[model samples]
Target: MTRKLTPKEAAQRYLREREPDVARATLYNHRSLLKQWWQWCESQDIEYVNDIDGFDLAYFRLDRQMEVGEVTLYNQMTVLRVFTRWLQSRGLVANGLADGMVVAQPDDASRNTKIDSITAQQILSYLEKYEYPSLRHVVFAFLWHTGMRLGALRAIDLKDFHPKEHYVELHHRPETGTPLKNKEYSEREVNLALWCCSILDDYIEGRRHDVTDNYDRTPLFTTEQGRVSHSNVRDHINQITRPCDYTRECPHDREITNCEATTRLHAARCPSSIAPHDLRRSSVTYLLDEGHRKELVADRVDLSVRTMEEHYDKRSEAEKRKLRRDEFGMDG
Candidate 1:
């Protein structure tokens, strides 16, 4: 007889089966979102994964929407749908139930688009003019140029810097504490433009706080207490991306004095502020725009080709072909 899997068992199996194929961050998200669904199932007494109905999925989505922002809810729901389909494939859920679930996109979804290359450059120019040698300057410059993930950047230590070579080596050291999203697979050396290196060197000499991480590892980026936390990285990006911080103008027209985002804790609430991942996406798009080969870029950025094309690449068909030809010295 075929065994009926409980909701929790199905989620664990799904994540474990996908571990080899997906990034650790993506896998973690899959685990977190599906666990939420499984928890709901437990509370509702929907013991078996096979019994998850369209109504149940919809209800669970409602519960999630209440818990997160529209963009985040949409993302989590998207993941949940994939999990639901996986359960169906195992004969644990209703057929086509995942396809049957409809999660409406919020009207404000467009507001979440990643910063474009030009905008990123413009931000750099602004930072260079006013915030040179500051953490904002170094972080934005690195994120906009290097297409590496935030986790990889966060995991860097003072020892990883090669000033003469102008590169940073990313390593996977989960045993010592810094865990890259792709783990050992993400280990690589990323070259930095001289100007970028200059700013980073300046930050190291003048701005970086003298501190270490929980593992007693000296971090390239630090707080007074120690290595900057992940939330610190997020907040730092948010702090730098704020329109008021860079542009010195409030497009939102909110009273700057009264703006909650003016405070460090609320920095991410600013509509114009971007997440660190946006910078990574912008960097990938920028490299593609500059006629870099996708494969080469993928290798340098430690991303899969499919991930580069499907998520990071934003070029039009003609733009892509032109870049390809340009790289080969062939004119179309």
Candidate 2:
């Protein structure tokens, strides 16, 4: 006889069992990805894991594709597949249920659109003037100035920060639930600009919530309950980047009354809204455009030089030519 387990219960047990085997960062990602699945199950009234079938999985895929990029959609399904297999092993789901779930092949297409330096500055200036010392303001400033990944940003703790020195250290602590993407290799001290540090100080002193995560560690960013969630971080970025939020006008000329993107949940649907990863890419390109050495940029961003040039560098050929001309004194 098969054991009965609610979808949520199975997910919790899976995560608990998998924690010791996987990197903390990976486990966090798995949890974040599976979260959508468990929510979907609740919406569909899937009382038990055994109630899930191939058709339910297919519909879940369709629902997710509407909300996330193809790459993200692919990752979500992959995690769901792994979880389903685990459930089957425990007799909570049917045999071959995991095999029946179809996973889409993710295309590694390059995203060319990014928030350029001018736009980034405009957004930051708006946040500074209007939302100063708030979580949204601090998050935008850190991502733009430091060019760190979302994982790295959330991994930051109060103890890792050194405002007096204008730098923060990144550490790998899997046991504590905050781990860098590349494990120990991703650890480094990132210097903050004086202005950035000033805002961070104000945020920590005045506006930040006094809370500790499950591990009893004080995160730099937090909600009233505890540390800020990954989805919340992404949502804050999405909401702030909407042109209407800062500029008070839509570039697409869509009426706010009829526009769905104006809503908080659908903010990313706006054409003018920028994703967090694109902001990081733009930061890398901006540094490179300013004639910073690629080696230094690579070290700061925790990426290889080759990867930075091939993937992160969004400079056009004409822009590259202009920079080269200026460097070689070809500009008359």
Worst 10 residues of 1 by lDDT: 106-115
Return the TM-score for candidate 1, rounded to 2 decimals. Answer: 0.70
Where model 1 places Cα greater than 4 Å from the true spot, the runs are: 1-69, 73-109, 252-263, 321-332
- Give a tens-digit lDDT track for model 2, residues 1-332: 77788888888999999988997657888888777788899999999888888899999999987786555667789998999899888987679999998897754443224788888888899998999989999999999999999989989999888999999999988788777888999999999999999999999999999999999999998889898888888888888888889888887879977888788877766766667887899899999999989999999999999999999998999999999898899955
In order of appearance, the predictions have TM-scores of 0.70, 0.81
Deviation from native of the Cα of residue 11 in model 1, angstroms:
13
- Candidate 2 has an lDDT of 0.87
Put down candidate 1 lDDT per residue, 172-240, tens digits, no spaces.
Answer: 987876789777888988888898888888899999998877888999977788876666677778777
C-alpha lDDT of candidate 1 relative to the true structure: 0.81
